[model samples]
Target: MRLRILSADERLQEAQGKTTMALFGPSGAGKTTLLKTLPTEETVCLDLEAGLKSVQDWRGDSLPIRRFADAVDIACLIGGANPAAQPDEHFSEAHHAHLRAQHPELAARLDAKRIVFVDSITDLTRQAMAWAKTRPEALSERTGKPDTRGAYGLLAREVIGLLKHLQHAPGRTVIFVGILEKVVDDMNRVSWQPQMEGGKAARELPGIVDQVLTLSLFRQDTDQDGAVSWQHDAEKGHARRLVCQSGNPWGLPAKDRSGKLALTEPADLGALLTKINQTLKG
Candidate 1:
């Protein structure tokens, strides 16, 4: 038997199966709410902040974390929920080992057209930091510094590495949900930006994801009678408008707001995903 090696061009051609998306917005921007509309089969959600449970009438199939070592251990690893323990208690190494042992199955499910959502990467970062804190030697250099560079770097590496690994799997969609934070402009003005609490991870995400979508709601000026006279664009013309972003991914900015993408009404997540998939196809 002869061994064949793929050239760089061939390798690049083989890397087209994965899609990475980042959903970022303010506290009530409906990020998680939008997720419920995605196709349910083979989809797994890793909720860190436990926000997914807040949906008033979300009736979808969900897999809960019981033991740390199930076939879907990544759910627990990235979900950011403590495994039935108090703040002082720690998740044991046995749990990690169990997860490692079953990683192959988890990877397989993801490769089988399964969608995984990590709700709020912030909590995962916190869990990683807490785990790192237990190992002083691994994070000794950052003992007193509030920068959290060392800790966050280690955390980012792990999370990004895992994401990359999942990306390589045959037919998986990995959706990462992140919180919005206020970033101070050079003029000391504050603007809402995707919250990347894990310092290095926050800085590194733009380069990792294929697309980063920021969701926000803007209040329009109203008349003295409190009637909304006109709706305003969330961001002035300089930046891309979500409603009118290139290709109208959400079908939101048509000539008249009568179609599926109408921005005047509440966001319809199913319609939004359909439009996004259509945009991706185009």
Candidate 2:
């Protein structure tokens, strides 16, 4: 196969300065809470579980259809939420369009300062599955009907494409929050590991993300007088040490043999970002 090459001018204009980050952890580990602190106008959350509204207190903001086509400097919240009346129904295209229409003046703001957040792609997979079930034609394999897996693939592809586009934008950052799942190791009867839920989508994530951090809770015991000093990762057995660089394609080593990113008390997001920036700069 012959490879086609871009001209000098084309090569010069190609955008190559962008980074993506992924935060993975158990529920209630404060992953989404930590992400809320980043400097952004709006954190576009794709709430797969419909939990964001209750947890984050997000009200609908309207952006006209025309404006959405050219939106910049906007924080986009994209997520699937369960409807109040139906309880089982999740946010769909009609809901998304309604929210977009509420925020009309948002179009002219399309610049690099934008941020996109996908809160829990795992839930999105569930929503996709639910959507697929409603389409009988999509369920026929011989007719090329989409199954739950196919629906999931389509949704994952769309989300990933959106993430890629946002990352390519100058001064833009995209954060993906995923749920941790437990799996038993067949090779070692006593060994177990945690990972994201989606099959192929989860596998493809690490390559695209600039940083992958796993947040865990820790507790500590203190001497006499009941001085209980709490710590993060007390359950993991490493207590005294804080903030260990676990996995880095940039050569940063893990603090211990556990192969997990060790975070210090107070969870220093800035320091983590600094380390990542340095690696990219080098």
TM-scores, all models, native as reference = 0.60, 0.55
| Tens digits of per-residue lDDT for model 1, 1-282 | 446899876654443334556666667657777666766665667666767766646654444433212312464343222334344322224554445466766545544445667676666666666654455435456454344455566566666655554444444456677777766778986555556546666666656665555565545576989886334444542222234232443322122111333443344434554454554333
lDDT of each: 0.52, 0.46
For residue 246, model 2's alpha carbon misses the true position, in angstroms, by 5.3
Worst 10 residues of 2 by lDDT: 64-73
TM-score of 2: 0.55
lDDT of 2 by residue, 1-282 (tens): 446798765543332233466666656556666644554454344444545544454332223222211221132323222223143222333543454577544433333234555566555445444544565534657776557666556555544544444454455456666665544466653321234334665666665666555555555769799786655442574432223445422221122222333344335544454444444433
Question: In model 1, where is the ten-residue run with the lowest total lDDT?
Answer: 250-259
Candidate 1 clashing pairs?
251-261, 252-261
Against the true structure, whose TM-score is highest?
1
Question: Candidate 2: deviation at residue 235, Å?
Answer: 3.6
> Which stretches in model 1 have alpha-carbon errors above 4 Å?
1-17, 63-113, 139-149, 185-188, 219-273, 276-282
